[model samples]
Target: MEQRLLAAQALGENELLDLASQRAKAVENWLLEKGHVSKERLFVLAPKVEAATEPGKDGMKARFALK
Candidate 1:
């Protein structure tokens, strides 16, 4: 019947999608194991640099504080 054929097609599609997802996850895990993919922090805030001006006609000086 047409209904049975449609059901079989949907099941096949779902199986293919699941297999593709699993393959993708395997590749990702392999990359991580090989260190080709980095999971480190992508966004890091750098220490703020402040500019101070001496009480003279000289130019401003840059200063940084280390914790």
Candidate 2:
């Protein structure tokens, strides 16, 4: 999934990004259908993609966090 996202970002394809967003939303929907509530889990949808090319910033961005 990360690979696909990276590819989509690199290609600057909005269709791919939109598709990814839909898939992510589908996961959230699936969780809700399974009786999993928001309080029981953390979800950060459509987060900013950390540039893989950025120096010394590999996997440094937090996608989800507790507040």
TM-score for each predicted model, relative to the true structure: 0.39, 0.42
Top candidate when judged by lDDT against the true structure: 2
- Tell me how far candidate 1 lies from the true structure as C-alpha RMSD in angstroms: 24.7
| Model 2 bad stretches (over 4 Å) | 1-12, 47-67
Tens digits of lDDT, candidate 1, 15-35:
544555555555556666884
What C-alpha RMSD separates each model from the true structure?
A: 24.7, 7.1
- In TM-score terms, candidate 2 sits at 0.42
RMSD of 2: 7.1
Judge candidate 2 at residue 1 and give its lDDT.
100
Tell me the deviation in Å of residue 23 in model 2.
0.2
lDDT of 1: 0.43
For candidate 2, the lDDT comes to 0.53
lDDT scores in order: 0.43, 0.53
Candidate 2 has its poorest 10 consecutive residues by lDDT at 58-67
* lDDT of each residue in 1-67, candidate 2, tens digit only: 9878865665344544665666666666776778566745846356343345687654323232222
